[model samples]
Target chain A: MTETSHAIRIEDRDDPRIAAYRDVRERDLIGRQGCFIAEGEVVLRVLLGGARFDLDSILIAANRLDGLQPLLASVPRHVPVYAAASPVMDAVVGFHIHRGILAVGRIGAPLMADDLLTSLPPRALVLALVGIANHDNMGGIFRNAAAFGVNAVFLDDTSCDPLYRKAVRVSVGGCLKIPFARIGSAEVLVDALAAHGVAAYALSPSGTTDLSDLVPAAQSALLLGAEGPGLPHEVLQRAHTVRISMADGFDSLNVATSSGIALHALRAKSFPLT
Target chain B: MTETSHAIRIEDRDDPRIAAYRDVRERDLIGRQGCFIAEGEVVLRVLLGGARFDLDSILIAANRLDGLQPLLASVPRHVPVYAAASPVMDAVVGFHIHRGILAVGRIGAPLMADDLLTSLPPRALVLALVGIANHDNMGGIFRNAAAFGVNAVFLDDTSCDPLYRKAVRVSVGGCLKIPFARIGSAEVLVDALAAHGVAAYALSPSGTTDLSDLVPAAQSALLLGAEGPGLPHEVLQRAHTVRISMADGFDSLNVATSSGIALHALRAKSFPLT
Candidate 1:
């Protein structure tokens, strides 16, 4: 780690400066002020890209310094890189973090819904998430959102924070690459998109139109919600309701799967599915 | 609760006959013999449908018996219905199962891939999984497979068991609805589909053809592998290589997302994308 000569060596679990990374599970319950944790090698690499969040600091197991040295080049010089042994890392985290990689990054001022919708290009496929609280579902939806070439993402205020540690990990850092904003409600987000000429296709088990029958516009957004209760009835009433055909009524697709399928359907159509 | 008068109360955790319900986390390691546990009320209802496997027994928190009574009517009279207090149930399962629902059932004889493939209808969409070891991916893939009207699922020998507790729960018992079988290798599964006049499309990040361009056949199969390694080269060579267009090279879709998107693409094409 010769290139990282300025790295700080964390010798004790009581280091007050590294407080943000302590007892993450407990800290997750209460807010992290304006800081969020990014874990594992992949997310750290994306964080080092410095595109989305500003890095506060990074901490990795001492043994990993050599392996990660190449990727650490882009990390800003002033941001402290804390290296600790596995024992200290485990002690501070309050669990055996097998990944042995962690980074603290500052969340920027929250993006507002209407301002974000107005800024997108005329040709865009947006993904609007509403009331999706499960971290895994949030991560999976964002992962698909990025992969399917979504121009931007809109999450309702009720949605789980995509920056939650597990969401970041599950998204494989894909969430970091995409621009996202949250609004007051699903209605506000959907209405804002409409004002910007983005057609909303709300997914539901009882949707009137099969996804295949729905034509994709130049600007379209697939509106999604949590698994069980699904999109709010009022929200579904406003947007064009669409559904993926299933084998039977025995089960419905997971919310993330709906995101992938619906986004693909919308994207493929705009590309002129021939 | 009145409808479930047949429920047997379990007060002790050490009863020898209830050994199968003991320490599920430990049992998952050594194997559950032929017995697999289905957790949560949704899965328990699916288990009681009596379509695939016979119900060995059901053990739910005693308080749940009343709530689950309507659904429990499907349980065969011959099968045992065991109800235990929350503490006793947690002690036996070695964890606090907040879902408070579990059912043990035999995993019948394994279905050979060749038999399952050859038995499918002429117009079929099959999902072939190769070297997918993650349980979440396994469950997610199965859940999507069911949603997209996949005719069957084929797992290569190296794939993780979809019946594992977490996978089963993650699948929302959709894995239970889907008829799946394992084969010796990806090569064998792809070749078997070929023999049945099914066109195989292997999904890879660096594939030759875009997914939208690949025409779906009367009988088609989408072959997928793990996220990082992806489909094997030999297997890719055997089938048509297709890739989903992504925003950039920084990230790829999760395998479950890949399955959902690919299956929808294939399914939508046959209905003739308008």
Candidate 2:
């Protein structure tokens, strides 16, 4: 088969051009400079479709190339697409490239929290997360945000990076599409949301208001925390506390599931799904 | 610290009493005769609270014994509690027993599908699952079912066993608390639900009615399928179809997240938070 115009075949695992794809598990993705790994075809497509992140190069198994032509055509020619046989691909990444597609993406300067808040339209739904350390939960939240039309997400410094590989895959590539920022602190986040006229609600089992009873404002933010050690008392006190009323003795819902339910309940009244 | 009456300290991994707790990962939990592994302190507490499943025995690390007194006291005197040093505990389970709590639970015969269905009160909500094979997803659905005050859960034989170890832990031990039955097939389950006058709603991306527009009857069932191959087309045809309206060009939400959202929506009109 004739290779696509953007294809660059690499026969050796030691090739210097493919350095970024090596020993991925050892790399500290959260603190790494500029580049992020987008695994699987769905996530790679999401990475390419958006303007916020740019393609650096892609390393894929030889057989996966033909099926991805339609998606690959959109990648600028300058963004090299490296094709390798399955064994070489596995050796480079230290694991089987089961999905047979991997991409090196260059992320631009993160959107500033204040700038992102100002950029929102008059009515917007924002998910403000505090201390959400689990990668899967982080990914699931981004997915829920995207599904229900949340304008953007603001993650506290304590939260894990959305671009982390597992989170990206678990989100089904949602982390690539949703707009997000690592804002400094939960206090600053709540204050900023209040200043922007967004009604911020902290979710907790002891929340004063029932989620069913509280009406959403024109602009709203749903505040969430990690599983066991929930939101700090100060953060909870800063925002209006709302609880997903449940059976009396059960622990609170998982953070991701809670977010989806809350987002669905508070979806814009005029959004028309109903 | 001195030991409690039920505590039996075991210094050797070869002890025959710890046989059920050994090399647990290698065992097939689904096809196993009558036993299920319940890990973590929370799940152990949940297991002890319920009467349907009886405790075979418990294995704990030496340090964890002091904190578990109240719960340990509740265990029947007939059931033995084995305390092992941390290393021996690790060797016995073939991994670090980090939470240091493991209980061998004996499941009674599965609740009959017709008996469970007929046992529901005048007004009830049920979550019926089809083809949910992932352990994490199975655990999650049980967690959500518990949170939203669902009366009972019915899983088709095609679904993974909810009592699998990972499912039990992921459910935060919800699998222990929630009354669940493994019924024969989607067809038989749907027919039984219809006979009981429960409105069964099969959830899918392509559906006739929006989830927001769904009106729950006196008794309701939300039918969910595995993520990629949603409910079998015939199953969707058999029950009224409903979808969570989402943004354009986006994939569907995670199966567990979808269940939480759909359950919350239907829960509002008919059920009250316990």
Candidate 3:
């Protein structure tokens, strides 16, 4: 159980050597200031293969270290590997650990809204979160964004941080693959969309215009909001409000689910190959 | 807090008076018998208004009892209400409190596979879960099923109980509204689907037939599996495998998200009325 190559072994929960791994819960409390953690081998591998994110280190359960040896072999030998017994790992994480492996990654700098606009193809679908505070929904949106051909994502200040551990885990590592930016305000986002010549459509269950009626624009940004409250009046006033027609008696679709359907409908009309 | 009309005060968690709310975690243990617990006022109201399910009782935190007074007024005096302090309520439920209300409902008697078939329309889109074990995905399927006009859902033996608390909560109480039945085995479900003149299509991320190309059958059953392992070989062998076309480099969508899109597309073509 002790045979290891490059991974560092630590039996202590308070090891200053693993300071980044300590106070894991506090990381999520700081909002945008904290790092994102990807758990399990599947998500870790996806994050590593994806473009331009800093991997802080990989932690492996002492007994299960061999299970991740092949993954370790692929990465640079200099990358630190923290190995600990299951009990020690549990104590450090402050929870019962199911996934035997964990990887901490630094959140990349936010992209300029204009950069996302120009970088995307002429015909592209983008997801814009106006004030979605639910971390799981934010994660689900990113996952759907990757599934459908969403070129980029823009999160207003009110949206939850997509790089939080729960978001990353819920996204199944899709947050790493999809290009996203955090714009300052809804007004700024609307203006940015205008500058890029991208039609910004707010998705509201009770919107006046039918989403199906709108001919897919060359490039479009779908503005989504939190459930119940929906998009702010100012935000809706600034952009076109479009509704996905649903059968009567149904209240509304979940925000993330609605985004998936909306993105698919948008992509169905004009998915950019380039 | 003591102004009670129908609400009965319960001072002890161990009191037989609250037997319906006892050992909820243990009751939720698979293969063990359990009653369904629905949280939040919104979901509780939805269930009461929409479904024919039996109500056992309602539990509310003492501080929030007044908020639920109107709802209690509508229910029969025979239906007991239990009130406790927030801390006591949390201690009994083994979790922190939110929504400040919980309703226990008796599980409806199991529906026969034939019953679902008889109820289905001529042009129907149904979701058949062959081996989906995740309760969240099961719940998501029901939510999407309701939204997209999936006529009914047939759960195979390998699938988790759709009425599990987590599933019900995640489904946003759609489990109560959506018509579903446990079909015992894949063979029985296949037979029932065939009897209803439904075409059984297994959804795979890498199947031969493109999903867009597959015309909606007079009646269609979209079969989905667990996220990673995918549809069981036997089920796929029995079904017509269809693949959802996606942009290259992205992995498969979460099973629930995939189901949502598949159901939406199929419903549009199959159930034109919806």
Candidate 4:
């Protein structure tokens, strides 16, 4: 049973309190005033469970509140919980939300790339990305990073915002859980990583050592680029080049897949197969 | 300059010759009559470069024809090439044709799972998939197979058709080049592989042996399931249960990424770590 005291029933789709949730696809692009939308039960749980992001409000379909009772109970009573009928919810969002759970949260203060790097504990694994503009790939990378224990993600400007709605959903709330900050250009990011005593490996189709042969340093970062252009030439020159040792003629693997494989390989560095 | 002899200009979007290329997104669902559309330049090149699929026709935008001259010259004279103005091309497809190159080809005769097994050379690697409904995942799997030298791919009946347009596009033409066949159910497919002296391994999070520790036989097949409800319980029981040994309290890696890592590990088995 939902705690009715904390809930506000919304009969009007145009209610002012729920304005942040209206026309979500468009608002995702223009209306993000330092606040981002967390969709689905899992992401909402992540937003409320952690102190990293402050919950602004939650707009949930009436039917879904019953199923989400346990999760809702966990939400701080001070936060507003707005409930809408399923049809009104669809009209407000301009599309049918199959998941039917949504929350708005302030992303908190800006985290500088340097601060993110400084925060990493020794013997950390980091995923450094350049030109990863595709939302799905970014989300997948974050999900992989969390699964394989990446300490944090450092992104160049060319990469998409991990806080983007689609990316948050695709990450399975990983973007919310994992710590990430957009640094400057690829060069600046790598230089900062080096300054912090983190060795970086640029993952490419052409590299000196097979990915399986990479021996991770006490602090390691795997530099990745978008699919087509791959890492810039200068960036590859700056870091140790690593290849996955694929068959001669085939094209390179997807960046997200390659990163996952590379992270797993590097993580295995500490284990040293007996 | 485009070769003018074989090219027919299409002023009308409704030109019957270009019928196969109309409203592709919808037609992909109900109208794939043993034939499929290949989108973009690279996939079109792969479609023409290989004989496994017969070219039914070629459609090109007037502007793009010049750059695709060499590719067009390679097409058999009997295969008619249709050219439309950019606007006509867009109207025909019901969406902007960004790459502006498309081809339709017959998928060729059906190959049975047993036939695919018998056709493999000695010391082969096969990727057997169950419930792989996502097109992008299917495409990524095929690309990985091509990269790591997977001899062929076997899919259970529940898996989506690899010839779906999105799957082909995502594969970056791997679907065109790599040989795949849908064999009955998961049990039947695994049984056939066992009969062929091929060792089968089901990848799961709870497997007994770490993926890094598995030894590959002369002929090996890695069985993978869809993301949510991994390979069925009975199937895991029958095969040697193998896992990637992920970090504690994290989800399993993406199915496509898992397959790539598993394939790489088995591929490395022949070169055991010293």
Candidate 5:
């Protein structure tokens, strides 16, 4: 049942209250007034269940409000919860949203990278992404970071924004839960990690150390670069470089997949028998 | 330089010789008379470099033919090589093919599950997927399977076709390289593994053993299920169930990311110090 305080019925596609959700599927509608769209029922649940960010509004198919009372009740009373017909939503979003749930929230601002590093626990696992332009890989890396108990993520200047709609969707709302800061170039990231007393392991095909052979330090950071042109030479030279061995003829694993394996490899070493 | 023998120019979007390439971007052009389209430069390179399947034809934007001489020269003389102007190629493919290289290849028949299992080496790593309907997950898993030196992969009947164009694209041609066969049900898959003296590890959140604690066997298989429902109860009962531990409140990892981590974890154990 739609809550009396929550239900703001939207009959037309162009309803101004739900305007942010319109044409969402045409391309990424990220960073519209420092806000990002959280799509699907699961991601919306993440938004409503947490207080990490201010929820601006939510829009859903009118028919789905029946069993979602508890979920909807969590939405702040001030947040306009818009309900529209599925067809109206489809028309507005420019794509059929099978999940029929959407929410908009401010991303706030990226925290100071140095402050984020300083705030970590003594024994922490951090993910540092360098030159990761693809939203899919960026999202997957964040999902891995959250899963493996990463203390923080520091993205280099060249990496794509994790708040991008596709990235947030791909991360399964991990981009919401995890604390991330975008910093300067790869060289600056390496220097910061060193300054923070964090042992850095830069992953690349040409790395000097095998992933299995490297033991995790009390404070560790796994550095992942974009797929083709991997970590900059200066960055790789500064960190304790490592590589995941593959089958004889195989060249490389997908960057996102590689990070998952690499993060787990380090995470297992640090948290064995936990 | 476009190889002299390979310079078969396609003038019109409706060319009969290139009919299968038409509207390829609209949806998957897989299983057209037992054929599949291998798109992009990297994947096409994978197909031409290997002979696992016969190439039916090759198509490219004429502009890209200059630097691809060696790649095109390797195409068998008997194979039809077609080239078109970028616009014409764009019109036929329905979506803009930014990579501008495509190939049609025969999938042949999927190998018999029993035969594929029988052919594995004595000490082998294999992957088994169940009810993985999503093409992206299917592709990512195959990429992991190939990277970890999994001797073979087996998919249950309920899973989607890996040769579907999107899956192939996602796998980065791991689907074309690694041998895979579709078996019956999850139960039947378990039975086959048992018969082959392969120790099966089924990943589930509710599994009895933590992933970090599991030791791989000489003949081991990692079984993965779809994201939400995970492995069926019957299948879990039949295998050594394992779970990748997460942070306190996190629920799950992406299926493909989970497989990469799981496969690598097991691979690290089976081939320790390799």
Candidate 6:
């Protein structure tokens, strides 16, 4: 745990000293495998505070190392810390850099849907996403889900990966904290939820049943669709279609925004004001 | 009233046949001057159905003209109709498109905050945005505002214009349906709301009061800031601070998503359940 084992300095972008940080954009397009990048001090601090993942390395511009010294000092002495000039760091990352601090961390192995469900308490809330490809929406949903006390999130096959850089960044690192599982399909999840006696609610603008009337159950799953096509007819049929009433003449709200509203409304009944 | 006065067909993208559809992205960035574009059939229909704005022209792909014949038949004979081949239309619009239709409408004169406030009914709900420059967020806020029965919206000096193409498109034409005004600053708007005897509620993650307590105000103005920086300290101090209670350890919701949840929570009190 000496200084030689903990810190490395690089002056060149292609120095192989920081191979983990190269081709970030291209890697992102292909789904960043093995590891995900956490940007900004706040997000990295959150990750460091949580036990969900192992940090691989820390990267900071040499000019900014003094500012992050206290944070670096707190990490395990064995963790590798790398510093580069600002321009070299930016060239390696393939984007104009602003946050100055970054962390490369190993993505933990995926969890099974059953494991996620079983880990929750009896009165648990979960999000079931369908066809939500937008990374921002996926991230926002996770952030909302965590804020509203949702026990876990289950992404249907069609949804985007929550660990994607943009999703993780947009989630403000909530993706790392929240327990999420990716299932093969909505049909399989619906059957599993039914077997577990969890009431499933499909969020639909055209739903006949008012969402407010449905009491929050001990275990409930909220299903959401993409912005445009909405939940497929079969998926809606499998769920108890519930609508958050809107003022007449307005179209449906954005899927992620609607998910936030729904989570807030549904979660309120279960979690009383503290 | 003749066919010649209404429908015009052009085979070339540069024929000057659809000047209204040219440089739409540039116009959006430059404040759109005197016009706004509504793309897709659904958005165009929403605009046509709403009484908030006047239509300047309608453009349909030549191959899809039959689909809109009924709508064309219903419109006033004075409005011009333009048709072009799908390729020509895409070239003119500077993007690949769908729904084979578009509409160009003159921008309505901006509404005055005082006028809109005076016209609002007792117990009216309104959204007051401060320093939210993201166009998509602006549009999403308007859509949420419209959906949750918010009577009007007031934008502070720092917000982007909601009429910009991306905003308008993201709003799904709700920007046209909702009444909105731009005020000079949050301070001025806070004072004005106080003068009108409306309760001003500033939404923040660190708010001292729960949002549920502020819903019963006879007239309320919900103040929101952009994501990250939140409401300016001065603005937060001037308005009653209210927070949407969240599960511990989670960060704040997305600004637009938070607005939706806040509006829905506040509006739920007045929702008529059958």
Q: Pick the candidate with the highest TM-score.
A: 2
> Would you list the clashing residue pairs of candidate 3?
none
**Residue B234 lDDT in candidate 5:** 94
Q: What is the TM-score of each candidate against the true structure?
A: 0.92, 0.96, 0.90, 0.95, 0.94, 0.92
**A93-194: candidate 3 lDDT, tens digit per residue:** 777669878887777676777788888876778888888888899889988887775789998898887888888888777788888998888888888888
True-vs-predicted CA distance for residue A163, candidate 1, Å: 1.6
lDDT over C-alpha atoms for residue A58 of model 3: 82
List per-model TM-scores for chain B: 0.95, 0.96, 0.89, 0.94, 0.95, 0.92
Predicted complexes: DockQ each: 0.54, 0.69, 0.50, 0.51, 0.62, 0.60
- What is the TM-score ranking, best to worst? 2, 4, 5, 1, 6, 3
Interface RMSD of each: 4.3, 2.2, 2.2, 4.4, 2.5, 2.6
Candidate 1 chain A minimal-lDDT segment of 10 residues:
A265-274
Which predicted model would earn the best lDDT?
Answer: 2
Q: Encode model 1's per-residue lDDT on A1-274: one tens digit a residue.
A: 4435857899999999888889999998897999889888888887777557898999888888888877776678999889998999999999988978899988988776677778888787888889999999989888887677677888888999998888888888867867898877777887787788888889998999998788877788889989899999889989989988776656788888888888777777674322
lDDT of 5 by residue, B157-182 (tens): 99999899989998888889889898
Q: Distance (Å) between predicted and true CA of A95, model 5?
A: 2.9
Clashing pairs in 1: none
Q: What is the lDDT of residue B119 in candidate 3?
A: 78
Question: Mind giving the per-residue lDDT tens digits that candidate 6 earns over B1-274?
Answer: 2233356987778877587787666666665558888887667877778548788888878877776776767666777888878898888888766777888888878789999999988768888999999988898888887777678998889998888887888888778888899889878878888888888889998898887666457888889999889999988988889998898766778888988888888777653322
Candidate 3 is graded, for docking, as medium
Deviation (Å) of B234 in candidate 6: 3.2
DockQ: which is higher, 1 or 4?
Answer: 1
What are the per-residue Cα lDDT tens digits for candidate 5 across A73-162?
A: 787878888888899988988888888888889978668998998998878888899999999998888777777767789999999988
How well does candidate 3 match the true structure, expressed as C-alpha RMSD?
3.1
User: Of the candidates numbered 3 and 6, which has the greater DockQ value?
Assistant: 6
lDDT of 2 by residue, B176-203 (tens): 8889888878888888898989889999
CAPRI tier of model 4: medium
Off by over 4 Å in 4: A1-6, A271-274, B1-3, B271-274
Looking at model 4, the pairs that clash are none
